[model samples]
Target chain A: MIRKHGIKLTSVAILIAVLVAWEVLPTALDVPRFIIPTLSDSLAELQRMWANEGLLGHILSTALYTVLGFLIGSLLGAVMGYLLGMSKFWEKVLSPYILALQIAPKVAFAPLFIMWFGYNSMPKLLVTVLIVFFPVLVNVLQAMRTVDRDLVNLARAYNLTRLGIFWKVEMPSTVPNLMAGLRIASTLAVIGVTVGELVGGNTGLGYLISYGGGQANAAMVFNAIILLTVIGFLLYVVLERIEERVLHYLPKAHQ
Target chain B: MALEFRNVSKSFATQGDGELLAVDDVSFRVEEGEFVSVVGPSGCGKSTILSMTAGLYQPTSGEVLVSNVPVTGPNSHVGFMLQKDLLLPWRNIIANIEFGLEARGVPKADRRARAMKELDHCQLSGFENHFPYQLSGGMRQRAALARTLSIDPEIILLDEPFSALDAQTKLLLQNSFAKTIKDAGKTTLLITHDLSEAVLMSDRILVLSERPGQVIAEIKVDLPHRDQPIRRRVLPEVGEYAAQLFKHLKLEEKAA
Candidate 1:
């Protein structure tokens, strides 16, 4: 009611300007084709992929690994995060291992995963799960650990049991933070799958990019990049919508 | 006995430090359905005494008996409200009110029934769907009061409950609470810094001293119990009674 849509308008204006600049810059500089192709070339490549029947199959195959990894990783992260947040001892025990895994370049780990899981979708799925899991766990744990103590005390004083305390007090307070972690995790899941595929695979957006890159087809590479970005952004937007709908009660200061 | 605290003295000892007595030989009793407000200089552990009454702490060497039963932890029959209303933001007005009922395992239909009844009593009926963020400070505090009552506890322990409200809102809420509780005939122990509130609403006022809070004075309020606010506000006796409590607090402050 109080000028709620101000940010949306500003974001739209900035996006329009960026798109216009992207379309015009190559022509102004007389840039060579296949080196840094025009946005139109990338768009054309996208349309061609769309015209081909199984482009969606490639997208869907890639999507399968991403989604499966996201759901599994997020669930594990939330549960682990809750446990870790509640108990300092477990956090001390496991968080270091988690942090170590997080800092390890996931790209380098993809080859070892292929050797372990096979060169098909499983390695890519594992990579996606690994990429998305840490942030969700870390963010949720921090949120749960730092919940307002006075409110907890109030609940305790009112004869609320431990289970009651969790549902009524802790979960609602931790949600917005948890949702942010979920959003970050979702996009990273996509990246993980593609990275895994690029390392070793015969299909998916990652494989398509590899196929294009090896042939020095910059237009094809940019085309794949554009599609990947759209996939990531669209997934991010949908999850964000879910987050917004579920956590309408949380204050904006939450994230 | 309705409630009793016998020779309950408490002190805290820190690492490599001498002991500090917070309440020394504090003792008190109140009859059922009686309104008693504990007043003192700010650091006199008036709140500690309230905590003791609510079974939040044990007096170092004494027993706190509520309805002749010793308090080991937060007593099931006692409900507490603090200076600030601690309403959960995620729950709407009705859900916030229903939280205690949910904790106590009341069925959803029954909980809704009770919450509806409480809403009518608190005059918050149509606002059940509004979240805490949508409500004013006074409304949130009223919702908190409703939450406390929903547990259906026999005794209510208030720790400086109105200290956060604007003076006008505080007065209004005290009047509202006084009227609502009188109809329900519930026992209440109110701890407040405001002398006039204690004088205006309580049956007896326990004035306490600094550091180890002790009952320095007990003043019985002999005001009319037809208890209409309009008439009570104009009475000359109200001013004199409030002044007496104020003087005792100041004297206790100087003594420490």
Candidate 2:
């Protein structure tokens, strides 16, 4: 517990030091606004945009796309992964295509999605879904495959039905891995939405960043970037908390 | 006989090779309520024998019977405890112990009652809600044993179930396990690499030859108090049986 408090203190101290350096360094060096905006300028821009330019609306739009895409992708991936996990023949048959999709860079598809969906939120949501799918599918498949054989055998010895074994053994064992994949996918979902917005969207933090860059308003770009970072951090923290609550029975890694 | 292996043999198919013989023409019988141990050198197919009895493996050649019926597949008549405690990490101690009953589809009330009784018997009454990770190794194994017995199987197969424990814990668990089996009057077959554990726990011990394993000899444990593991370990009779098993295993190893 004391160690945990010490770690928290260290992180806060480091953050403050970084923030001070970011605010002071540009002034000391007399860097141009377009090259290196001061921290104060970014914060002032953030306040101005929040009060007058609908920055909150942009944040909400991006968040909606992210959540929808994450939910659909993770659910569909879990189902597909579970089915493939149980059937080796099917997995062998379909794995190559899944692998191909996984290896092809998702960001490269953002323009194609925008072209197909015609400059709307649909393209961004689809991009987020596509980005979030593979990690979950692969992780769930691997988790199912790696379930301890002894436990399965025990279930069989006790005459557990096929479905019973799946419920009591396979499902619970896959949870930790599934949670790991979801955590990664959540962060990726945010990135995917940002890419989509950069390519074609009219309103979103991603669009704001792109617009700010086009106009050479460095403070506006920094404010948008800061918002994106906060959103990503919050998503990660929520997932982590859920993982902790669900896997409380497991031996902690440090132990 | 509660369990019988009639001229049983098993072989495995190796990749890019012909059949690899595991057990060779092995025959044995475990009488009702008997505690029998099979001790052999490593890779002697001791575990194969247990798996075959549990119907987890087909005997490649001969037959395994339980209660005068030919064994076809996993049935409710037998329980197997593996070397690892194998308590599900997600389950609390009581829940782990109730697994077999749950699998058998016993009523919730009945399952809870049986699990609580077994937990008390294993001396883990207060740890009902503590998960497997929270327990010590000895405690986990005890919970595993309780899980096995919860279903009231007539025959129990133990595959080196205590081999991972420290010497002190091993002796303590063995003494308690022997007494529990005796009190319950269940037929048991134990597979072990440890010679003294066999002598201390078994009413009779079978020594097996090296790979392509077959029964080489049988020694009836003549100790007066078989349930008392610590005392049995110090007994001269225990030493004789252990020495005899060691000598036979050594000879088999040299020949192989």
Best by lDDT: 2
Estimate the TM-score of every prediction. Answer: 0.90, 0.96
DockQ of each: 0.49, 0.86
Residue-wise lDDT of candidate 2 within B1-256, one digit each (tens)?
8999899999999998889899999998899999999988789899889888888878999999999898888888999998899999999988898899886668999999999999888888899999998999888999999998999998999999999999889889998888888888899999998888888899999999889899999889878777778777777767777778878788556878
| Candidate 1: tens digits of C-alpha lDDT, residues A138-221 | 899889988998788778777777777887888888998999999989879888988987999888888888988898778778
Candidate 2 clashing pairs, residues 3+ apart or interchain: none
- The window of 10 residues in a row where model 1 chain A has the poorest summed lDDT is A1-10
User: What's model 2's lDDT at A34?
Assistant: 87
How high is the lDDT of residue B204 in model 2? 93
Interface RMSD of 2: 0.8
lDDT of 1 at A92: 89
Residue B132 shift from truth in candidate 2, angstroms: 0.9
Say which candidate scores most in DockQ: 2
DockQ of predicted candidate 1: 0.49
RMSD of 1: 3.2
